[model samples]
Target: MDFYHESVLLKETIESLNIKEDGIYLDGTVGGGGHSSEILKKLGQKGLLIGLDQDIAAINKSQETLSQISDNYKLFKTNYENFEEVLDSLNIEKIDGFLLDLGVSSFQFDKGDRGFSYKVDAKLDMRMNQDSSFSAYDIVNGYSKEEISKILWDYADEKWANRIAEFIVNARKTKKITTTFELVEIIKNAIPASARRKKGHPAKKTFQALRIETNNEINILRNTLDRMIDRLRPQGRICVISFHSLEDRIVKDTFRYKFLDCICPKEAPVCVCDKEREINIITRKPITPSEEELKNNNRSHSAKLRVAEKI
Candidate 1:
């Protein structure tokens, strides 16, 4: 099966941007240009869509995909966290909108050799930027038990973090855990038989934690929201599509932080703490896929789209 990262919440995401025909926009993840192509369709002759992706494959794929739609787009080979540099390079002062489709793409997991999926028995390499030297292999084999445990808990909320870390450490002492299946077997063994039978695959959380660590996705997303909002023009929109609770929480919290008018406690009458609201939270609650969309794309089951507009 040809696995393209089908854009999740395509209509809602496009509508959230409230596309301005002659305005400038950015697709920070540009995975396979699924959203970018749609953004391209909404752009007029003067409007421009600038896309960025750390994965070279995505950069190339989006370059090909968006080209079919129009020539009014540019793809950059870098992470969204460094979007400032890319914008400066192009002399772009501010953008009218920004869209971030966060987390791993379907293409990465489906490819198998990239190792983002637990079902795939490929080597444990989940580096979204294939050029990067660090990968799941390093974390699985090289990280300390404590570090591994923390990653599983903090990144994935894995209940079996400590036990899984212990299992990984003990198993590696006998032999290096080099492949995806090797780690998957260790996770299955570490989790109790009852817990393993609960819900979803036993190795899912462990794999997710490793993938997050390998790519430093959590920190990047945490640091990027404010900067993206800062770069947006007045009344500009920022749309984020997050795949899991961890990511959805970050997006929600960031929007909440920006939506705040004052943080002063109710007890204090004076306003000493000068915290200013930044953006207006457009989505009172995150927008999820429709029943039809959920039925069509099982991978999008956890997806949530949250939007905010610059104040």
Candidate 2:
């Protein structure tokens, strides 16, 4: 799986970790072991790296990739949101650093049979975890028009959400919308010919909405960010690379909230509630890929890396 994924912002993410030679690190999304291999290389034999990914294919590939580097890494087939469970099972209470590359790997998009890309005419199965009972097919064929529209609007801010939902609901009555290309056609048809001329694929936003809903991506990130941060040792860093505005906003706001000592109104002279600053924001602004990185990987175009250190 050498060609499975390309690590984005590799150098920057490692640097943000401030990896100690004997430090323990967590790579929450070990897609093809790109980031985990690098993290392991920076470690001494005693410096263990625990990795997680919901995709079993990723776990197997990561095993192969990191084995060539060293046996210091252990990968599990699970989502980063379940890091606590994995850590608890391993008796690992604290980690020196955490790296969460929030972008869906290029491999998922490139694998036509997995049904992640609208350009691919394959089954509507965008489950990052192959074992997931839910898939894009269920969302498209089973959801009410209002529910589908809400997902598109809330997840990707698709302006044509209502029209697309209407189209999907109407079309599915005749036969199940069972493939990427089938949904693409519906999305294109829902859009006016003039609106279809917009930049990017007509199905891009709709597909994004479905994938996210199928995986519950946004909700997982929102619910789990702080729990992971709380497990970091003092001075331990957490570096998160997000691919879009929604995820970036969560990272930004969470970091901002953690950096604040008091939530009392600015006009209040005294600190009333018990609140202390928990972390120091390392990136005043999220780090964007360099021009070279952007050129090398178009998927990195929207990538933003934000980091914070536990106090």
- Residue 234 of model 2 has an lDDT of 98
Per-prediction TM-score to the true structure, in the order listed? 0.96, 0.97
Report the C-alpha lDDT of model 2 over 142-254, residue by residue, as the tens digit: 99999999999999999999999999999999999999998999999999999889788889999998999999999999998999889999999999999878999999999
Worst 10 residues of 1 by lDDT: 1-10
> Model 2: clashing residue pairs?
none
Q: Evaluate model 1: give its lDDT.
A: 0.91
Residue 171 accuracy (lDDT) in model 2: 100
Q: What is the lDDT of residue 275 in candidate 1?
A: 91
For each candidate in the order shown, give its overall lDDT on alpha carbons: 0.91, 0.92
lDDT of 1 at 161: 100
